[model samples]
Target: MPAESEFTVTPYSVDGNVDYEQLLNQFGADKLTADQRKRFPDPTHPLVRREVFYAERNLDPFLAAANSGDDHALVTGRGPSGPMHIGHIFPFYFARYLQRAAGTTVYIPFSDDEKYLLKDQSIESISDHTRENLRDLLAVGFDPKRTRIVVDSADADVVYPVASALGKEITQATVDATYGDPENVGLSFYPAVQATHLLLPQLVEGRQPTLVPIAVDQDPHVRVCRDVAGKERHDVEKPGALLSKFLPSLDGPGKMSSSDDTPSILLSDDRETIREKIQTHAYSGGQTSVAKHREQGGNPDVDVAYLLLYYFFEKDDQRVQRLAQEYRDGSLLTGELKQLAAATIADFLEGHQQRREQLGPLHTELQPYRLTDEERRQALQTIGYPDDSLARQDSE
Candidate 1:
């Protein structure tokens, strides 16, 4: 067993006062130094650009820990409310990239069980939704062998132990530090399940580094996981985290929701549907009049079409710079920009659907169960088996 000293935790900071301009300037100066821009180009808009900067900054510690082979873990899951949208792709993709670069183990837990409460959807609906969601996630191009994907319902035996153990470690102080209240049972319990997923990999055979790629809004959950892991209640090293910014809704800067049935595009939408939706519903930050837009140029800051391009399209930096210039100079009309975005998005979705179809079924075979009789025995031995009734039965 690896000693507790094998894991290292590093602190991170984000400059509270650093505005968009300073961020852009820093990005420009540091552009030649790092290969991140080659993989994920600098976003044209200031808001997204700043977000990208912050995401990379936050990931530095996790990246370092991963290189050191410090038994870190990455945790991410979907709400299973409906078909995943394009926005759902960011966190997993970021995780895949970092995991591949650092040779870390990645665990993607299907939070389908949590969807029962969060989405207000029926338990019966969860099975089909979870299967379809897993299919979609597999299609996103993560390595099946390297990643361990588990559905919360069918895998209850595996989940329950980790969840119960972590739950006992949650003090009122820790709960308040996370959700700002110990009364929210749902919040507290959910974090326990999530942390269980993170540390579960360490309890299994061939332990590896765990790093969770998630959005900033989900930071509270990761914080709880880190705290629980650090307490060593689960007898495994604490997992590190990498956080991304939430992908904004097509309607604007507000939440990109599947329940709202708003303008956001789903992964299942066909080419024609995608085109129609973008042309009709996609918000444009340009002027109502062409004349005024030509004189003043469109604001890329709030333009939905431009933001989509930054997220999806891969191009030379010069091309992005030119697009920003053309949009601002009124040379690129809102209609044309929307058409371009729709085309780019349609291509991306079509490719994903094809990949998903090739992934075949979403079953236990793809992501093998983490705990077996032998594996459980080994984990208990590593942690000096607990004295609880359930532990005695499992041990027997």
Candidate 2:
């Protein structure tokens, strides 16, 4: 953990090292208690069990729904500013896991409009990224019947009106405080769209619990949505959040982390590319030389290769422990550890890549996942819009 003074966690930016415990305090969210952890569908996910997903806000209801086999949902999103990466897609897999374990509906809102407003890019470029990202998302094999993929611009007939209603509750002061000064009004208004994303399932499915599993930096978005959900006129409950720590950057923990500009392992990385990137860039915690490393064992805690495996790539608990112990006891060299992580990552990517290739045309494959016409009308009507007129306009 980095010194408290050095780190900051906000909705839009995370700088320095994150103190997740302190973050729970500052964000006014609860840490995952043993009781709550037990409530998660049997076989708690590694992300939850290992505490990568560390804190939450009002998560009990969602857990209750999962345990009781009642209606519930998981809302994880994508900002298509660039290509999909390993760090970016794990949540979708986790959502799929929950869907299998608890039959939870998933709502994936792709924020192409937000990325276009924030990034220096043309609408054409943003649309291109959205299409590519959509392909990767489709390959995740979510249940099409239970999943709804909403693109902000593409689904504007539904998203825009709901956002317009929610926008009334958000003050400019709150926006500035949460996101700092917005570069433009689109950035200022994007939170309302986000609130719309978080609350849409309830509006459409009838006030069931909604869970947003996301990186903790994105908690502020949940908070804003929760706040909007609190309005008395709305028949919705505040959405819960399952917050996660940042997957470390290749450089190491608290030091270097993944970003758009940073060199990251993409979803489509070939075996050779995966090997080269991990071998060339993975930060090591072993001694300077072989003899020294044998004398002073490597520290898996600071080793990016070990962290990468432990974080998501390696699924077996015993295997990860063995690797850590081996590295710590001088039995595993930095090169060997890097190779192990690289191989694990390469295998995972190869599988995902194969799935990607196996997918059909993007639009046809995505058809089952897109929102239904009735769902759009329901969401609009729930948010105080009379869909009779709006539905006609949309159809026309």
Candidate 3:
């Protein structure tokens, strides 16, 4: 493991090589136990079974609820700063897997407002990204009836009021400690909005277990929200967390960034573009020369191509192991490995792009997935803002 000083992780920034185990220790999250793994639905998602999603905070309740056919939910969100990238889609896909296997309710929130506050970009730019991101999210094939997509700016009718209520529960000190000193008041107040996202399912559907499947870097957000839920003033339990390691960027390990100097394999990338990006940019763990690589096997553990396949692109367990073994034993050359990953990723993108193409205009396709009026009312009422009062005020 790298020394503690070698890495830095936070909600807004991640630098250097991350030590996931160290992160779990630092974050006070428990590693998923052996029994916890078995408790997951059969044909477990690669993220879970393979230990990509490796740690948790109070996961048992969610699992118990899932097992007993009780209401349970998964909250995984996005910040639409730009077009969606391959790294951006993992949690949604994982949520979809659980939704399919165990009837899990999925709530996807797009924090467009937060992005606008963080980036030096106009509202129009953020809005454009939000539309594009929503299309990609819709293509993930979540069940419209079982899923709700909340865009912060678009759904403020429900989001803002609840966030205003919850905002009282979070201290500015807590926000400062969690996210560092905010550049703007909007960011300082954003934690309330984030907590609102985590607790929304329970607020609307009545209190049950909700799990936030998010990257480990974002654990502080969950911690802050969990603290708010712990307060007795709210009639809600602390939302649990399923924390995952950062998806490796093509250039090397560390969180994949849309604005990175190196290119990310975007969800919209075509076959040729994906192939070119992987070939040109993916960091290789093999020897400098082909002859040297053949003489001394490559290390797939650190190879970007192998890591991508292992992480998501290649799903077959036996095949993944075989490829790793070949690379380790000098039988698989670096070029050959990159080619295989490119093709597999290209194939995956083809399907995602096709679904994206099939989508109607953003608002029309996003309609069924929006919160129902009753849902909005229930959420507001639960958060201490009765809809009748708002209605009365509007009439007055």
- For this target, which candidate reaches the highest TM-score against the unseen true structure? 3
Residue 343 lDDT (model 1): 92
Q: Could you tell me how far off, in angstroms, the CA of residue 61 lies in candidate 2 after the best superposition?
A: 0.6
Write the number of the candidate with greater lDDT, choosing between 2 and 3: 3
| Global fold similarity of model 3 (TM-score) | 0.97
Q: What's the lDDT for candidate 2?
A: 0.88
Q: Estimate each model's TM-score.
A: 0.78, 0.96, 0.97
lDDT per residue (tens digit) for residues 1-396 in model 2 = 456667887766677666777777788988888888778887888888777888889999999889898899989999998788788989999999999999999999999999899888899999999999999999888999999999998999999999999999999998998888999999999999999999999999999999999988988999988889998989999999998888877776642334535578889889999899889887889989999899889999989899988888888889999999999889899999998899999998888888989999988999999999889889988988775965677999
Displacement of the residue 192 alpha carbon in candidate 3, Å: 0.2
Kindly list the per-residue Cα lDDT of model 3 for residues 131-229, writing each as its tens digit.
Answer: 998999999999999999999998999999999999998889988878889999999999999999999999999889999988999999899999999
Model 3 residue 191 distance off true place after TM-score fit, in angstroms:
0.3
Query: Least lDDT summed over 10 consecutive residues: which range in candidate 1?
Result: 7-16
User: In lDDT terms, how accurate is model 3?
Assistant: 0.91
- Residue range 141-256, candidate 1, lDDT tens digits: 76655676766776676676767767887776766655554334665577677766667677764344455655545655666766676773455555555444445577764345
Off by over 4 Å in 3: 1-4, 389-396
Alpha-carbon shift of residue 357 in model 1 (angstroms): 2.1
Instruction: Compute the lDDT of residue 345 as modeled in candidate 3.
Output: 92
**For each candidate, how many residue pairs have backbone atoms clashing (under 3 Å)?**
9, 0, 0
**Candidate achieving higher TM-score, 1 or 3:** 3
